[model samples]
Target: MSAPERIPPRSVTSAELLAEGELTVRGRIRDASNAALFCTVAHAGQEASCVYKPVAGERPLWDFPDGTLAGREVAAYEVSEATGWGLVPPTVLRDGPYGEGMCQLWIEATQDAELLALVDEEEPGPGWKAIGFAEVGQGRTALLVHADDERLRRMAVLDAVINNADRKGGHLLPAPDGRLYGIDHGVTFNAENKLRTLLWGWAGEPLPPEAVGVLKGLRDALGEGGSLALRLAALITPAEVAATRARVEALLASGRHPEPNGEWPAIPWPPV
Candidate 1:
């Protein structure tokens, strides 16, 4: 038997990264309930690696319709881009090995060692904020820490506006270039206020000037006859889009971080 050909990595424009491409499934991501594959995609003779999650691989959720998680993921990227925060990597919905799904640029972690250390400390290091405590294991309580970086702060604001339902620790990625990105937004944009996350350290604090600016841009972009609403409508229900607009309005009206008030837990399971 002959060995399969290796797909050489090639640089491509961001547009190409999210456009139609030749997808080759590589492997699976562990611990994910839905099917996620590591894949290399080729477009215009340029190759890029990304994470692919097909709709057909989605597990049914009581709150969301079947085969909708992948769309939700793309919807999240749309929101992120509309805000001009660029917190989410380029993501697109397209057909893949298992059927139609979302494909997002893969982000490699940069500050893993530093972040790992911070998580282990109850009083996390300076420039870090310990929001809450989680019982990790062995009767030890690990502090849920978030970086004091501006990008991360903007991400928190973005989550509030989008009503991100799950912002696990692992979803916050610091790239080698010092850029931070957020991923795994399959559970976002719900009609209900389902913003569960470990980013409560900024709760009650006034929204920073940059954060407020981003929200304003997002608000304008989501207005009637705006592009954001149109883009989101294709991926999620109108109710979800309305809820997103409402959340943005609420955030702008409050002018500060929100306090957890929902019946659901403020943090995600397996917090890390």
Candidate 2:
């Protein structure tokens, strides 16, 4: 028999990550019900670790239709990248172990000790912001905290725009290079106003000029036949895309941080 060709793994550019390739499942994240897997992808000699969530494995949600979560994750990444905040890791939709799904660059979080120290604190230290105090367990009080860093704040703005239904504290990742990454965005961009998050600290505050500029930029990119709007239409419903545009317009029109609607709880269950 003839010998099979073996391609060496190498580095890949951001644009090339989405190219067609075979994804090898290295491990499974058993904790999540959706059968999320850790995969290694080699394209053009470039090797990278990516998280893959196949549509076949996705658990059906009452509010969100089944098999659509994967696309929403990619759409969130699209919005994040378009905002120029870089809040979301590079992601792409591709065939995976189970079926068509989302593949996102894996972000290695900082040490647990550091995260524990911050979580133990009664108030957020410098460069951090306290979301609020809550009875964590059996009357044991704990404070919910988020990075006060501008990048994270930008993510908060994104959550508002996308109407993210899940922004748990643990969803925030502290990268080794010091940049923060927000993940687990499958429950986003609904036509309804469903912004549940832990970033209400900035509620009612005037939007900084820079943040407003980012919003303006996104709004322009989401206009008729705009790249972002067009991309989102493929992932989600057009009405959801219109809702995103409306939210951006609302943010610009208000010129201030958003306040909770008082209907749904502002925070997610298990804040951290």
Candidate 3:
């Protein structure tokens, strides 16, 4: 991370902070290697959300040192927007004049409501299906056991392509509208050593029409010029990208990646 681009903070005073103490924060609170505050904001005429590092933590990611967290966040946002799939909306990551940690936009999500309801009821039903991919449909919906087994495999391959380290079932939120949303992009597009998830069970398989369509749409939306390809070029090596392209093509040709081990790599423990 480096000094973020100079930009005005997206105000959310009109939307009112919804955190534990009315503080504007990112939407999801995570206590991983570090404690990050997540919240959603809509005060700036549109909904935006962001995550920031707490002043106190074990040790920040090497790339996110003084003045760099904001920069990394900005770059991450640029990449997410460049990619068509819905991402946690980006916001300006700024330094607080009073020596406080930074703040950014809140990622809007439909998971909060649905997850709470499902947890309270101890299960999900109807519109929800347990696809058994990574952080998707875990705990909230009944595991589809054999549900779309092959599609689950393709999702894994995509995770590998994106180098999405945290693709647990919970990370893939299926909105009521049926569109699956992917989030938690703290780690992506880095050219080297992109290993951190368990989504691909069918590596050599052909991508479903749904996935092919979405990927095609996203690539088209990216157009010929965008920060995506460049950022990836900078962080993700062309060789890696080429390898991924080859892998995708292979999967398309075969329609599935198979493992005889008879167990999925590390999908969410329980399909929601």
lDDT tens per residue, model 1, 1-272? 99999997666776476567788988999778899999998877678889999988888889666339889889989988887778999999988778889999988887644543337765868788767876767998777677676777888888887788899888988888877899999998889888898888788899998888888888888888889999998999888888898888898899999989968789987667
What are the per-residue Cα lDDT tens digits for candidate 2 across 20-88? 556889999987758799988777766778899888888889887633888899999999989888889
| Model 3 ranges off by over 4 Å | 1-30, 39-50, 53-83, 87-157, 190-198, 209-227, 231-272
Full ranking by lDDT: 1, 2, 3
What is the C-alpha local distance difference test score of each model?
0.83, 0.83, 0.43
Least accurate 10 contiguous residues by lDDT in model 3: 14-23
- Cand. 3 TM to true fold: 0.48
Return the TM-score for each candidate structure.
0.89, 0.88, 0.48
In the range 87-109, model 3's lDDT, one tens digit per residue, is 43343434332223334444344
What does the lDDT read for residue 246 in candidate 2? 96
Distance from true position, residue 196, model 1, in Å? Answer: 0.6
Error of 3 at 10 (Å): 14
Error of 2 at 16 (Å): 2.0
